[model samples]
Target: MRLAELSERSGVSTATIKYYLRERLLPPGRRITATQSEYDEEHLRRLRLVRALIQVGRIPVGTAREVLAAVEDDSRDQLSRLGTAVEALPHGPEPDESDPSTAVGRRTATALMRQAGWRFSLGIADEFPAFRMLVGAIAALHRLGYACDLPHLLPYAQQAAQLAVADLDLVEEFTTPAEQVEAAVALTVLYEPVLLSLRRLAEAEESNRRFGGGS
Candidate 1:
């Protein structure tokens, strides 16, 4: 398809598409004529991946480039590396940081968790660190004075639980319960450090942004 058509289909602007091409974020399209190029499915796929990383995952361009490179490599560890990168979504500003000690917000969130007698699911702990991060985010919010009202956040939790169940069920074919539990624990430990490190780095980057030092 033509650049105009690609841009319209991808919901990205023409200039942005050109920028992506210049950055080599998008693969080179076929040069159909001296002044014309035609993009194909590969280009569309690359554009979608870039959009997911940039728009949905909130990853920075530099990091996304590295991640895309790692995922595309033919090395044995490429899948694992891609999995890790997928889990490293940008967490934007912590809502807890806004007002961590409120009775109806962050604090309320914690109290509700304790009341619900919730235990960290071992099934997910080993496979996805987002569970641990969610817990940490809640705790951090409580510490920062936000009232984590259980009632208010219950809908979000319910939706998350539904998604978790679906995900677990989907993966049941790949591993047994015992193996899943082990993987969950391993994933949690492995991802914890990565999460902390990335968060620190993000903080520094955010600081630079505030100080007019970041591009």
Candidate 2:
């Protein structure tokens, strides 16, 4: 299809598509003439991915570009591609390692992972802000007089690991490398809120069952 059809199908404006073309976010369509080009399903898919990254995931264009580049780079293996996509996500500001709280949080995170026997790549925890957030949550709970020791947290870690395996299995279902990359990116960015909402609902149901008055 032409640019107009691509824009219509994607719900993206032709002007924005032109911008993406210039930014190299969307690959050039087939050149039919000096000024005319035609796009295909691949372009449509890429446009949708770019839109989701920017509009829904709230990823910066630069970061989205890096992710797109990683997705398209056929030289890298699947794991490397997924790692690159993850690394392109925005993270919180680096903690001051010298701070006592930061030091304690890091130590707690390390201990929890060790006790849980969670196998991870070297330095992966250090690079992931989500891990740091987990550390901070544990520290905060401890400060509030709640025990967040390894034994207390092991169940959650085990459940999360199982979920991660399931997520990877879903990614493996896509036949093409591009489809797998798209699936990985979409699931990573989109399913987080769904998971959190489900957890919240489950907690509410459990609380109501245990504490609510008969009605």
Work out the TM-score per prediction: 0.46, 0.87
Q: Top model by lDDT, which number?
A: 2
Q: Judge candidate 2 at residue 102 and give its lDDT.
A: 67
Could you list the CA RMSD of all candidates, in the order they appear?
14.5, 2.3
Off by over 4 Å in 2: 128-130, 136-146
In terms of TM-score, which candidate is strongest?
2
Q: Which ten residues in a row have the lowest lDDT in candidate 2?
A: 90-99
Residue-level lDDT of model 2, residues 125-211, one tens digit each, is 876667777767776676666877777888888898898898889989989987898888877887788889999999888888889
The sequence of per-residue lDDT tens digits that candidate 1 reaches over residues 1-215 is 99999999889999999998888778778999998999986677678777766665556888667655544554535335535544554433444434434223434445544554555433344245454455556666667667545775677677656655755554454354333432332333344466668779988889989996767
Per-model CA lDDT versus the true structure = 0.60, 0.83
